[model samples]
Target: MNDTYSNGKDVIRITDVKLTTVQTRRRTGAISSHIVLQLSTDAGITGVGEISDLDCYRMYMPDPAAVKMGIEKVALGQNAFEIAALHERLLAYMPSYFRYANTYPPFTPASQIAAGVEMAFYDIVGKAFGTPVYNLLGGRQRDRFEITYPVFQAKKESDTERYLGYMDALVAEGVTRFRYYVGVNFEQDENFLIAFRDRFGDKVQLKALDFQGHHHWKDVLRIYDRFRQYGFELLESPSWREDYEGMAELRKRVDVDISEHISSLAQAMRMIRAGAVDVFNITIQSGGIYQAKKLFDLAEAAGLKSLISTTQEMSIGTAANAHLGAVVPQLHYAGDPVGPLLYVDDVVTEKLRYDGTQLIVPQGPGLGFEIDEDKLAALQAGLVEWDRPAHGANYVSD
Candidate 1:
């Protein structure tokens, strides 16, 4: 028999990993991948964890089998509570040649392992102690979380009407916050901005305007001036990821709050250190929970807010984000942790359901979720090809 404590039980063995892909109607051009981690112990207790593939970005789709193989080799017979140690070892053993890429391929594989294992450990701990993951982190600050739906590729002249209609539908469904793909070329989309401001008025409490790093200083400054009139809350990725100086300058020039979305926590810190942003968009999987917590701490110390957003991951990743957001003190804005909502189908026992605008965090164990193995197997069997070329791959790549 396994030893049990008031803080739950220790993880004895990692049982299995299941990965699945699902399509979504919300965002037209991408597929959602969900990774589920199952953990078992000598005490006959079991836990489940969900993580998403971080390399969903074009030009870097990793083989799920490869990820599974790599993780299985390192994860079996490991203690789930020692998540940090596992993450370190995975990083150390990952091929150095694959380290220089923008998307960490090996890291993605290991992310599943680390997240799954950690979640299972948390489950063991939570189940034994009868506490939620949020309680373990620091207790829940808020029971409900706000969601921001993204309006992608709204560039056409008629797109304003289409988008407004879409927003209206979502608003009717209880979604108040919105993140529009304003892109960098603001002048071209002036009508859309004007329409958005006019339509929602004060009913909309928050707006995360995504500029996709295409705006220049002069244009962004102009757009900020206009957006201020509508009382938008945040401007995400207003400038290029590399332009720290520009970001700092924009922060100085604009009165509105600014946030940045880089690939990792290290980049987030660098931007924060440079005094370039007011909020940090921390994707949980990009830099696992432990490192993400560190980033949140950094943001808090620097008097900056944290926005826990999604990396277009499946429900597992979304759950992890919710738990992390629920615990962290620095999380100020409700994030786009709605990958499940966006998808047509999700592979999980319990889907992360939203009540109107507020997203309720799962209160079970660990990350508080389970995988539907039968559904996952069905999805995996549907995989036609692993290397489908993503759109605009050449353009996004340097």
Candidate 2:
């Protein structure tokens, strides 16, 4: 109102921020949090945004209080229209954000602080213009985005039966494609893939990954062939994350299209230069909407596709990724926007749903989602104050 409105674009000034930690009721080790930024405008148009979780690649979980404080320090009194400046200021305050955290220098810390801020900035801008975030990202190329559901890695014959039975419920809900990471063993994992092909092969799409990355190059080659025979589309992270040389050689050796699990943008460039990766399993949390879109463009420029990957986030993160995924034209593979359906419950009110094989992107302004106050309140009420416990797979019970 003071000087940012000389150009008639400053409608909102930052007022307050809120953080809520929600724990899963039905799952053992799956708990995620949310950060809400409330922007109070001179015109009384309150712009709202929710921070998506970015804990999978972080060395430590983001303290929501710290993120809220960071946001206020960077965003106070700034014009909401200055999205780029806001992000650049954020970068200057803390440089080198990660979709996944890095072990090197010249990089900022890896958490959802920047991502949450980015989403809120876009949300304010979108509502001011009466448009969606995808439109802000150079317009939409497609209406719906394809997704891959996470099936628990089955290691036994009975485990395969249980996986099938679990998928049966999802199939009824119109899910046609699903995937899971490799458990601990290959032979046991092979039996699981064979079951999917034998049972639901013709009815649904299939994808598999070995994120454990324990297999040798020869082992990866042999396993890729075995699963390819069963009609698995892509094999992801079959080896270690830094095995670029091995991945490059394997890409040339096998018929399976291998994807690299990228934590840093440099990792992505390395994969592209090496001609190793077939697709990118990227999370919006890796670098937020801006860098992720650029990464997708880089992949398409190199004749590959970028899949908006995920690892158990709430509806807010899923919605954020969906907005990015909606605009990208190269999202031609099974995506990991599978959070709302992954656990027993999500904290947002209007959670995303999968109709058949695709995820329907929310069409509202900004992230296109509203905070489920009732759900949030309930989660807050039910939250157990636990000390730092050993964390494990979100679905796997310890």
Q: Highest TM-score, which number?
A: 2
lDDT over C-alpha atoms for residue 376 of model 1: 67
The deviation in Å at residue 124 for candidate 2 is 1.6
Off by over 4 Å in 1: 1-11, 21-30, 39-47, 51-56, 94-117, 120-130, 184-188, 226-230, 262-265, 381-398
Inter-residue clash pairs, candidate 2: 98-286, 99-286
Judge candidate 1 against the unseen true structure and give its global Cα lDDT, from 0 to 1. Answer: 0.64
Off by over 4 Å in 2: 1-8, 25-43, 46-59, 99-111, 155-158, 212-214, 381-397
lDDT measured at residue 283 in model 2 versus the true structure, 0 to 100 = 67
* Error in Å for residue 58 of model 1: 2.9
Candidate 2, residue 17: the lDDT equals 55
- lDDT of each residue in 181-212, candidate 2, tens digit only: 67466687788777777888688877766455
Candidate 2, TM-score vs. the true structure? Answer: 0.85
